[model samples]
Structure formats: C-alpha cells, structure tokens
Target: MCKQSGTPLQDDLFLEETPTSSVTEKVAKPGPAVELKGSVFTLPVLRLKRSDLGAIEEALSERISQSKKFFENAPVVLDLEHLETPAEVLDFAALCSLLRTLQLVPVGVRQGSAEQQLAAVEAGLAVLRGGSVQETVAAESKDKKTGEVVKQVVVPSKALVIDQPVRSGQQIYAQGGDLIVLAPVNAGAEVIADGNIHIYAPLRGRALAGVLGDASARIIVQSMEAELVSIAGHYQIFEERLPDELFGKSAQVYLQEMALTLVPLR
Candidate 1:
C-alpha cells in the first residue's frame, strides 16, 4: 500500500515533491504615458479692471445672453494686469464663481502679482505666463555688393498636412498656421488651426480654426458633416443632419460680425 502524504509525489522518482514557488505573468497597465512635448493653445483672456463682483456678474450675464452658444464651456484666463492697481484686493473665489455662472470656465490667472497669484491658487486656478504672441519672421538677408541689410516681412507658418485619417479621440492642432487633412476626420476627433482648416475628405468631427483669435480664419471641408465648427471664439453645433444639398458636399465656414457663417465652398 502507498503511504499517504500532504504533498504530491514526483511521477518519475515517486518521491515527495518539494513546495514550488508561484509564477505570474507580467501585465502592462493601461494608463497614459508621461511625455514632454511642445504645444500651443488659445485661451480667451478676460481683462478685469475692477474687483466689484456685482458689476462684473451683471456685465457677464448680459454678454452671455447675447451669444450663449459661443461662450458655452469656454475656458478663459483672468488678466489682472488691467486692474487699476496691482495691489488691489480681489476676491478670486467669488470672481471664479461668477464666471462659472455665465458658462465661462476660469482656468488660470495671468499678469498677477504675488498676492494675487496666491489668491488664484487658493481659488484652484493655474498661474500662466504670457505665451509667444508674435508672428514668425522670415530670415533676413544682406546685399553682398551694396552691403545693405534687408528685412523681410513676417510670414505665417506653413500649412501642416496630414495624409492619414484622424481616428476617434485623436487631436491635431496647427499652431500659427493652417491644417490640411487629406483623409477623413472620424467622429470624436478634433482638429484645430490658428489660420485655417482644410479637409480634403469627410469632416465628421470638431474643427476649430483661428484658435489664436484670428478673425479671418476659415474652414473648408470636402464633406460638410462636421459635428461642430468654430472660428475664433464663435461656434456652431450641428445637432441634426445637414441639408441634403450641403451634406457630403464641399462647404466653407467663416466668422462674420462675430458670428459663425457657413456657405458652399465654390
């Protein structure tokens, strides 16, 4: 008769097997990778002059009522530099609350002093510095024979081209220039340009042009089926299907008189 034991015996030698260590397969966790890259973004700067909460709220309410669509969920930077005095007391928390009431999200505070910055932090706001606000200048040249220097006029950045389709959750932004997508922009994707946006294929996602407050920015799409279109700070959403003649056809979007205008791209 075989002896009974708590551990199993080895099949070949018929000897009791020693305890073995457990092995596990390594798995990669699903999370966003940490990467450092250069980027540029446009933010509406609300220049505040007075700390009067009542007046500010009233004024903001009036403005919002006029064009609630444009300001909906808009992120704005508080510019305290325009205040009468740098040391002037400001209730940042109250001001932020007032802005939220008007559908404007206050993301950061710019041009504030030490005290004001501290106040902004307490209000859960970021302190941002002035970004590059100037246009790109071309290379200067000098006349070899005349020994005279010639300055060339500044030119906007060259257009960025995307040859592949923009998948959902993908974002492409052209800073200080135009963006041209040769492939379709799937729904839930975003494409932004500071100058203009040109889509050679269907545009079913959101497209924002003139992100840096360029009023002349325009959007041209081969297929007019965008979920949302925006120029400068003006925006228009397409809740329903586009017109039969306009859908899946060439169209252009622009801003006129601080309003978004869409027309056929002829």
Candidate 2:
C-alpha cells in the first residue's frame, strides 16, 4: 500500500472544490443629460410713506388680492424713498406690525434715510443703499442692451383678455405682451406689462407698462381712478391725484419723453 498519511489527494479534491453559480450578464443603457432654463420674471419694490401706515396696509392688501400667484415665492424690496422723516421719528414696531398684517414679507429696504437704515437694521431687515439699487438697475439695463437671446422667448401680441376683478394686494404681469382686463382693478392692485395694458373696467389701482424698457408701451382704461401709473420705468403717484373727470371715464396713459401722461381715451 502507498503511504496513506490520513488524506487522499486527487480523489478527495472534488469534495473541497468551491461551487459557482452562473449569472446572466446585462448591459446598462446610457441616457442623455437634461438642461434647465432660467426664469424671466422680475420683482418690484413697494414704496410707502412712513406715516401712512393705513394707506400702506390697504395697498398691500389690494396687491395680495389681485395676483396671489405672482407674489408667491417671490423676493421683494421695500423702497422707503417716499419717507422723508427720520427712522427714529417713526415707530419701527408699528411698521413691522402693519407689514405683517398685509402679508408682505419684508426682506430688505432701499433708498431710506440714515435713521431709516438704522431702524431697518435693528428690525432685522437688510438695507440696500441707493447706489446698490442704481447698480442693479444699470446692470439690468446693460443686459437688455446686449440683446443676448435668452433661452426663454417672450412673444408680443396686440390683444389680451382678463375676466376677473383685480383686488388689492394682487399683481398681474404680462411682460412682452399686451394685457386686457375685463374687470375692475381695485385700489392697491398692480398691473405690469412690457406691452400695452388695456382695462375695460374701472382701474383704481396701479398700472406699470413697458417694464422691460419698451418705451412705446401704453395703458388704456375704460374707467380711470388709478392711484399710480407708470410707463417705460417713469412713474406718477397721484399725490394731487387725477381729477374725477379722469376717473369713471375712459382714459389713455402713455410716456412722453420718459414722462407719464394720462389723457381722455376718445
């Protein structure tokens, strides 16, 4: 007998071999990458007087009611340019309370007096100086002049139709397109368009046309009781206010040498 040292070499090799299972091989297919485009909307500032808390609240409420969609998830700058009084002279807490009541999230302030800036900082609001505002405006204007084609295109049209009452605290925007309102635009409501804006009903709110530098844009209203009107970036607050003859009647608003003009719509 061959020397059996308690192990059988070749014969027992089969028992010690590890088992393997067959797996089907599959290849993964490659897909194309997705591209995203940027937004085309621009937000405006809410300018108010320091002592006119009631007016501010009312205006904000009207804005909210007019265009809830636009205001959602939007950033805003409060332009305190109209406030001539020192911030120390006004009640910061009261102002905050009024803002809250109007459902306006005040993130920052611009064009405020020195005392106003301090008050804003104390109220935990960012203060954007006039220089900064001018820089931003200039940059935007430069971008427009460059005429760099954006991924998103805005088509211009002559006619539009809106069949709802625009309430205070609401805003409607039709950049690069005409806007037609078949209902009333209540006080505090804002209507903005880069093209013409036509309201067939009472316009007791704010109207801003040619927002994106379209100097030829115009505004036509069947009934004009507007608190403010703007065209081609130039604005007019009816401090003396438009005459009653202009209100409850047809009117047309336009820009003349960058100035705002309202005339009877014959």
How well is each residue in 126-208 modelled by candidate 2, as lDDT tens digits?
A: 88643131111222222477777544334455555779998998888874478999999999888887678999899999888
Report the Cα lDDT for candidate 1.
Answer: 0.84
Best by TM-score: 1
Return the top candidate by lDDT.
1
List the pairs of residues colliding in candidate 1: none
Model 1 error, position 92 (Å) = 1.4
TM accuracy, model 1: 0.62
lDDT of each: 0.84, 0.72
Q: Which regions of candidate 2 deviate over 4 angstroms?
A: 1-160
TM-scores for all candidates: the values are: 0.62, 0.45
Candidate 1 lDDT tens digits, 1-266? 97666554665444556788798878988887787897655566787888888888888888777657767999999988779777986888888888887889999988778999998999899998753234443557898899788888767889999999999988999977999999999998999988899999999998998776678889999998988898875777676788887899999999878888889877
